[model samples]
Target: MTGAAAAIAALVDRRLTVAVAESLTGGLLVAELIGVPGASAAVLGGVVAYNTELKATVLGVDAYLLAEHGPVHPEVARQMADRVRSVLAVGGVPADIGLSTTGVAGPDPQGGQQPGVVFIGIAFGSTVTALRLDLSGDRQAIRTGVVSESLARLNEMLNEMLTGA
Candidate 1:
């Protein structure tokens, strides 16, 4: 099993639900999570906000915030996670953790942000944090790297939660 699947399985075993909001990686993060057996138990759902409008409209991201900070900013990632959590909670999935990835994964950079520059946000309860990763690769490779690293970070956070370390 992939590391993401395994980490998700661990979360499920602990009865923790997870939701993802993806931008550059699209639905690839959800695909990796649901690729595992019994992912339905832990994975609440996901939002693929490929467009800025949808990110603001459907995910409830603030337009002023997006316009002020742009989509690739860390605050955008944090808002994405918070919005996903709120959505999942209303849906009764009630996710305990939310993960979001936003970035430019492309042959040419957009939004004045460099390609392979990713912001991954993690939210647990009222606490939200973002990690920035500057990866080196082609489009697909960068996306793959983001997915892998996001899962690793999730695992680390899970370990911290479980071990209180």
Candidate 2:
């Protein structure tokens, strides 16, 4: 199975729900997850916070952090993941997992970062982790890579949980 499909299956099997927050990858991360069959059972929703201001106003990213490190920082990714669960809550019940992507993917730099510099943040249970990826590709390729990497990271985490690792 594809990584995205595997992650979706794991989530469903574990009765876990996920919300996504996106920046450099736009909405592609959520799109990839929800594209899998039966994803509705685990994917609550997603936010495309491409704008720095929207990261705070919509996803509740800290304004001071954005002012200091911009939207491409690892902390931004972590905050996006940590907060999206609540932001996309249903009936006051937050999702079990939050996934976020924040980075620069382009021929030009963004927030002083070169293209293909990415962070994928994942929040599950009480732990929040940011995985940094220094990729090498054009804009579209970089974005695609981020989605793939995010799913792989989720799959790894799910396996760890399942095996009690």
lDDT of 1: 0.88
Cα lDDT tens digits for candidate 1, 1-77:
67887787689778898999999998999899988888888888899999988889988889998888778999889
What's model 2's overall lDDT? 0.94
Candidate 2 lDDT over 1-165, as tens digits, reads 999899999999999999999998889989999999999999999999999999999999999999999988889999999999999999999999999999999899998999999999999878999999999978899999999999999999999999999
Residue 2 Cα positional deviation in candidate 2, in Å, after optimal superposition: 0.8
Off by over 4 Å in 2: none
lDDT of each: 0.88, 0.94
Query: Cα deviation of 165 in candidate 2 (Å)?
Result: 0.7
Model 2 poorest 10 in a row by lDDT: 23-32
